[model samples]
Target: MAPERYEADSDPTDLSLKILVAGGFGVGKTTLVGSVSEIRPLRTEEQLSELGESVDDTGGVDRKTTTTVAMDFGRITIRSGLSLYLFGTPGQDRFWFLWDELSQGALGAVVLADTRRLEDSFPAVDFFEHRRIPFVVAVNCFPGARGYGAGDVSRALDLDQGTPVVLCDARDRDSGKEVLIRLVEYAGRMHTARLLDTVGRP
Candidate 1:
């Protein structure tokens, strides 16, 4: 038996891509980033004590104290020499300014949606849409959560026909990675389409 030639074969599509994980408050942005990230995820969490109780909502996420103040960062090596830098953005309106800095030079974004509070994702959807950045919506399936079909979410978010929406569980590494891959595929298609358009093709 000959030695396996795995080392000789390298992935042709090995390019580094930066993707932003964005959503509203209490969404699973951190969970999703941590799930697929190969490295120890770097997170900035602030203990939300009684001080924030008067301001922050205490309905679905009442038990949560610590909140992601800045961002959660992680890395995932998709293929040999190809990796992705995942930035889990803070969802609160106070941190909205950070979005511009975090999203600079990024390929696109993955907007995490929680069906229970679908409206919470409005800001994230709007932010990307306003910037004309290519993005995909990933419904994070929390435990015991009701299933909302992609179509319903698309209608709720008022996304365009070209946008891709899919279900995912931020707690599951494979599922989370699949969501990231879907966004990557969408970005690739958009890039190709733009190139074709630039060449005078309809």
Candidate 2:
């Protein structure tokens, strides 16, 4: 069966969109989902243990003691009738298999980035790019971390020309909402462009 299509001007009275929150370990994907979700978010976090120390890279996030082993689930109503279902993908490579399942019907994705460990976000960027999935990079402004402008991050990440890069505090509801809003807008534009291209074809 064909997948459902999400349009920019679709009926908002009863629209529900699926959005994935993905990024490197400790980049705050879980925090972003929890902050924006109107309902209590579901988490699958496990305490960091000695056995996994060698596999989990806690370089920049040394203070983080727990890791998300599965996905985080949440729901947010953007308006009276428009709601978003958020799925936060586990950041570790071992759990990557779950990503395909979580992203099956997603409208788009938010990739959280930490300036202190920017390189860790590379895999997520590559994943979305290779899948032709519309995604926005939300830089989680961690305290004491060097602040990088959106342009600088876009350049450093080598993002596609029109991909968006926004600064946000994942722990704040307003900031997290803004990131999701940006992703929705960007995804809408991308969908429209693709439709126009298809129509223009022979």
Candidate 3:
């Protein structure tokens, strides 16, 4: 069973953490945010049209009717002093112009991966890696999707050592929230390690 929902945190928070939700098209980026957000998520999905037939590859996601055009925005309060702002980037290359602006203050990111179309997530992972952003790979387990172990995914993606890969159902509220929590914790660890490295260097 999913964890119980937390009450709304009306008190101003001591920290506002920004997290980017990035993944390939039709990989459930919006679903993850909508499932866990305390507030109604703002989505800019438009019906898939002929304009994308020549560009957007919908091989595994043919059933998807809509695609995010710009970005998805959502909010969740982790506690009294910490809140999270989720910004989901558009998957298609045409809308990638918005990513820089959305990623400006992100603490980390969650890159949703659909097992059936795993390769599609590579770009997102590369983007974060190239930018030195802390992120986790959350496999979005769709029905009938093949089960792949975390290590297998890590190997396939060529993720750096110590990076985390987790299995999740984007539709589940608790599972989605757990993904965000894992990102926060991982980022904390990385930050601490970097601090230690700096201290030890001198």
* lDDT-superior candidate, 1 or 3: 3
- Estimate the TM-score for candidate 2: 0.92
Query: If scored against the real structure, what TM-score would every candidate get?
Result: 0.89, 0.92, 0.89
lDDT tens digits by residue: candidate 2, 1-202: 1124344345644778889999999999999999999889999999999999899888889589999998999988777767788999999888989888888878899999999999999999999998888999999999998989999999999999999999999999999999998998899888778877878955
Give the alpha carbon lDDT tens digit for every residue of 1-202 in model 1. Answer: 1111112235654567788999988888988998899999999988877888777665676367778889999988776776788889998777889999888867889999989889999889988888877899999887666788999999999998979998998899999888888888897788677778778885
Q: Which candidate has the top score in lDDT?
A: 2
Ranking by lDDT: 2, 3, 1
> Model 1 — which ten-residue stretch has the worst lDDT?
1-10
Q: Could you say which candidate leads in TM-score?
A: 2
- Arrange candidates by TM-score, descending: 2, 3, 1
- Total backbone collisions for each predicted model: 0, 0, 0
Candidate 3 on 1-202: residue-level lDDT in tens?
1111223346543667789899998899888889999999999999888987898878888488899999999998776677788989998878888887888867889999988988888888998899888899999988888889999999999999988999999999989988999999998787667777877855
